[model samples]
Target: TNTPQPKRADRSKVYMADLESALHYSLRVEAARAAALSGAQLDAFKCYVATLVKYFPGRSCVQTYLQSLDTWLRNWTEPELPRSILKEAMKNNRDASHPAVLPTNVTWVGCQGSEPHFRGYPCGLWTVFHLLTVQAAQNGPDKELPLEVLNTMRCYVRHFFGCQECAQHFEAMADESMDRVASREEAVLWLWSHHNEVNARLAGGDTEDPNFPKLQWPPPDMCPQCHKEEWGVHAWDEQAVFTFLKAHFSPTNIYLDYTE
Candidate 1:
């Protein structure tokens, strides 16, 4: 005589089947919703969807699917992406001519600039991996990121870009920028300092001399943020500095009270 199986097992299987069907329907609904988005909103939605597919494949229960979707929506719909070097790079390069073809924010941060400082920036492959890890950390009971994704990012960052000090600094700055700082004033202060440092270096014959430089060979310290190393130093192009600042910072107000 064979023993009878418990009724609960049969019921559990049936419930699972129903859950799968619901999940299929929900995925379709989400796809439709994504289709309706436009501009940056649509782009971001698509990115999230793509990320979900890459990290979590195969069929899932309706409740699990919906929970993951909701969690992703909440985390990504914010004004900023989460903390990651790639995220910072993406934000900086969002206005670049080719945003879609590039890696996510962290890889972008590691790679976007032409400076020698950014030569070892992360590649697209590594970027994908790093992003997968971030997705895992963001997951909770309602959401779960596959451990595989995190491992992928780690492997890519380590293998492709290696570890460097500048890359590390860029990551730190990206983290700081996310907090929005005290105000635009504070942000500008940092931007201005960077500008001054570059200009001062140029004035001291640090950069290659050009016939038609944007600013004078030795630019003047026009803005209050500007500092002079010597009294006899040549005056710099105040206008050029102003233009560069405007392009980068887009200051809303100009305070000239620092002028003589």
Candidate 2:
């Protein structure tokens, strides 16, 4: 008899399952400490807390989960318990909380790829930021609010993201031009443009999934008006791109498929 294959998530749409999986993985990695963290790691933990508190639509369960984790992290070292005691306390805190819920209104089609090594974490994470930026823009009359999302994302990636070189590169990019973003709308566009640039740079690199090659996203087929030929060079119509992104990342686009 042949062994059974695991059922794969739907590749055509972003499943809530994958996004929650990614978030859970991040929380475990960031919090799995057997000893007290160094100063830098502590700062990273602080950033993680800010990322949760900054506000986004939906996912009330996730907000509660992070809040509980933050409570434990803050109280940690008050009495400096033995390592075994501390570990048990952390375990109890996590167990008391509800299961991790997917972030609000985030989706990426490639999350389920032909090969297991392709798209998973990066895709899920980008969807989260994209959803967050869009939601921040929606909730904004405060021009500074949207940029808060961008900055929090930068800090989270700089400190918590496992890929050090990738984190440094993202930090450099944010440092280079993020200050120039002046309005809520501009913050949304800035992230989309930079995401495209990263896609362009990695298009044919070893990490590129041959089955789903990276492209300047929202290709012509997806949004014809977003692209154009200028002096025989490809370019995007900023207004169209902005419109597409706002609609694409909106809550209505989120799918509950494959979710618990």
RMSD (Å) of each candidate, 1 decimal? 24.2, 4.8
TM-score of every candidate: 0.23, 0.78
Please give, for residues 1-260, the per-residue lDDT of candidate 1 as tens digits: 57865232221011222222222322333223332334454344444444445443223332243344445555554453432422232221234343222111122222223453432222223222322333333332213222333323222222222344533543454345524433322332333343344445445352323422334222333343333445787443444543444432221221112111
lDDT score of residue 151 within candidate 1:
28
Q: What's the true lDDT of residue 230 in model 2?
A: 98
The residue-by-residue lDDT of candidate 2 on 146-177, one tens digit each, is 57778878877876787778788798899999
lDDT of each: 0.33, 0.68
In candidate 1, which residue ranges exceed 4 Å CA deviation?
1-163, 167-183, 195-230, 234-243, 248-260
List candidate 2 stretches off by more than 4 Å.
Answer: 1-13, 30-35, 38-40, 70-110
How many backbone clashes can be found in candidate 2? 0
Candidate 1 lDDT:
0.33
